[model samples]
Target: MKLTKEIQDSIPFQYANDVRSGKITTGKYIKLAVDRFFQWIDSAEKDGYHIDHNSGMHVIEFFEFFLKHTKGPLANEPVILSPYQQFTFYNIFAWKDENGNRRINHVYEKVARKNGKTAGLAGLGLYCQSFDDEEGAEIYAAATKEMQAKVCWEQAHDFVFKGIGLRKIGFKNTQREIRFEHRERNGNVRKGNFRFLGGDSKTQDGLNPSLAIIDEYHAHKDDGVKEVLESAMGARQNPITYVITTAGFNTTSVCKAAEDVYKDILDGHKIDNHTFIMIHDLDEGDDWEDPANWVKANPNLNVSVSMKYLKREYTKAINQPSKIPNFKTKHLNMWVDAAETRIEDHIWMKSDKKIKLANFIKNGCAGALDMSSTTDLSSLGLVSNPDENGIIDILPLLFCPSDTIDKRSKEDKVPYRFWKDLKLKDYIDFEGTDFSEDNFWEKLPVLIATHGNQIDYATIEDYLQKLEAIFLPKWWEYDRWSATQLVQNMTEKEIEMHPFSQTISHFSEPTKQFEKHAYAAEFRHGGHPILRWMMSGVQAYEDPNENIRYVKNRSTKRIDGIIMTIMALAGTITPEEDNNESKYNHEEFTL
Candidate 1:
């Protein structure tokens, strides 16, 4: 634990100790940051922070004041950095704090395309806009389009007009911004700016930035502009959020749910020391025509990349299989399994038709529960809306309490008493509940009761009186956890429930609205076998941005009746259908 002559002349800390001692050919989170950076440099006094070699040699002397080739054969020279960009500027300016602050405040550097990562995170957003001592430092580069947020804001405006004290920079470019003013050590003077935002921008809340270069975050399709730039970074301090990217085929992005939480914190199964992942792909089933697995995802191979332009695009993607998913998702960063599924069990067994619930008497349904965890198994799901042959039906019931339906039908071997009806302390089939243990049913005062693996409000007011005697439900969305007698009987029968919360900001738009009407076949269901084995045990997991959730993976399986049929098809579908109030007439009935 003695290393410091600039981290022993770092080359990204000797290529993260030669990719953690195998002599390099990377991946596996740079060998899990070389065993979590020498157990964080041998427990910097039991992990509270230390190493600040003058904020890591003032970001390696501000990248030696620029110039090492803005273009061809070394255009001005000085630059010199490439041991993984001096190991990401010595692990992001040598992790400080103890009044020095900056303890890696979020950075997700996925690599690949000419791996300099948009000119080194646009030169760390121009050193957090004029030297990291943030004071009015709102710096951005974020993108979704404004031509991908002006590719790292025109390379941090050509490295602040080609270097040298940022070319005597006084700031102020205005016309889309680039400002500067800084001056601090207490004499005070703030103004830092440097902008460019756009996940279809409009309002990203009152931002406080202090450095936010998200550039190409997998062309974001929701994480609501990284949740308003992380809730406008609570008026800044240690605010970073960097996210630089490359591998993107949109596997329900938020950059593929933060690349599955940076591959579960590089497989030690998650710890997150303020998120600093460096995922340079290519490992799983390597040999992408092996040039040592293409330097295990080009960490600036031959600096600014060129093994003769990746062997001429790996010989035109080994003979054009449609250019092998854009050269394995842009110069091999990877995730190209772009099949982002929702249903395909033969179109979900061709929406297994069999409809019944006395065929919708009062009309228009919606009710999607989803409880589980008292011995697991709770779902009620309903959804009817699109009928004039537009199909759209779906039922699913499930429950399971008659003493854990014979131990979850021999531990989920399936047949749970044929979608068992309802019976908590024992049995009361949706209606007549004398609950008998003697007098007012052992004071259980039964109404939707079950208090162990939760679900009470006993068969929801007898399934809302047999679903309003079939069809009559404009709402009832449930999912967050229930049983306070179903929110006190849906607030005493004025029933219009709602609750939803299953995060990824409210189940990522009803999971892409139940994957777009179940891939447009519209949706109808009944052959039930525990809702077709919980829709072939769905796996969805995205959430670093455009939410997808359906949790419990690695095959523990039980998609709570497909999450109460996508929370009753996200309040019974609506992409604009007021063809005079989206249907249901029963002679203008008054119930």
Candidate 2:
């Protein structure tokens, strides 16, 4: 029943231990990732899973034995993986299912540039192709551009041509592919192929890949290549879809979408056992100038990317100023403008406790609306009165035109159609059919889909009336710019409509309060998927007077739901307190 020292000092757990002991510096996501590893190990057997240490180290030993540094200061030297890389390799190949197949088949790795990502993965591509006990394995280096795909494929090709182990074993190659053939003990000939598959390639038809190395995945503008390769892997017995990249500029890209899902998995909002996620980035509010903090982002600080090289880039960014975004994104592994500070995401996730809405319905609540545009998303945010525990429950009801759900979902890169169809029974706990018909609020879907190509105000008014009959909010607040008709209609219906001006003076205190509630874990939102997405994309703008308000710049994504939450929380504050400065310590809002 006891484990060996080698198992205790396994690469992943060793790195996790180092992180806990302060020997390693990283962000909260990495902390969560290591915790996930430990939790999985603790329950592996009960969950019909087990760890195979030899199988994990087999991949590592393969790299050290056959792969060589194709290009670098250590060119032609044997490929020796660093601690972080050892951790990555072991995780990829260690765990086994009940059937002894690879436990994790998909890997999402986000790290800073110049971290030897490509070389390590190129070696992995070779390992999966030549060994791994898979016959006729089809390995691919995939990317949006042909040249980009060739980068990894070329490194892998060079490793085979330049290295002694693979060459002596015999292989054949073309400009874009490498082939290996062997005869099994049963006298059956097995063949393997490794090549580049680009989105711009002439034909992606009729292909099967056992290992897909998606390099610099953030550069991909869409999911064409990723989806194609993923779908093609269905026939393989044990397939791996490996996406490796640094932080990027495009927030709505497929890579960012994958990152969002990965974050949810780490936050315990979603369960995905077959996917492995490791994100290395600087923690929020870290002083980038501090050399001590650099290791958090650059795991291979002195190994592949030198401290001197980072110093030079940092100096240039300081002098040029405009280059700061690139420096922060590529070197610090920060998503730069994509995730500009509004709130700490980890703290926001921590506050995502379940809410039994029925518990607070009769207590009354405050409502706010952000009717963005006739064609885009409109949000209705409701905040419940604080209970004796002082915890506020927030619920967001998003609305979009049914006809435009598909189009808008594609454009915004968020699932509008799925959210639109979400029934109240899925998220809300209406007490014993009192607020439901057939145990479901059929007409009161959480994400309402108004008919036709533009949001139907009449349908919104109707839903408001239904909500009004049940919750009886104290006041309904609206951003005055485009809600004239809806405001008039609701006011005539005897539903109190108060105009909440969208200004720093009106929003700053509430925004600060929301941040306070998030940090204190005093709010619950049922882990609403769409609301969490909006919160993650919010960017804050600060004035000279230290007033902060969420802003959606050209580069930024939508924050309509977030704005609605702030406005709704604003209505809950006493009018006298709304005009006064926030009582919370200013330093606490630094995040």
Off by over 4 Å in 2: 10-12, 338-591
> After aligning candidate 2 to the native by TM-score, how far in Å is the CA of 24 from where it should be?
1.5
Question: Candidate 1 lDDT, tens digit per residue, 1-591?
Answer: 456686566565666777677776777667776677768888876878877766766776677664344656776666666776677667777888688887788878777787777766766677677777777788878776555677777776776666556656455455676888855578677668888888766766678887777776776787776667778888777788887777866676678887887788768787877677777887777777777777767878877888999888888655433345556667877876444333547666666665443333324767767766655666665777776767677765556556566566676676666445322223222122222443422332212324444444465456554554345667667754554457566657666566665655456566666656665656767445556667666655442233455654434457777878777777675333433221111122111
- The TM-scores, one per candidate, come to 0.35, 0.58
Q: CA lDDT of 63 in candidate 1?
A: 70
Ten-residue stretch with the least lDDT total in model 1: 582-591
Tens digit per residue, CA lDDT, model 2, 416-436 = 777766665566555533655
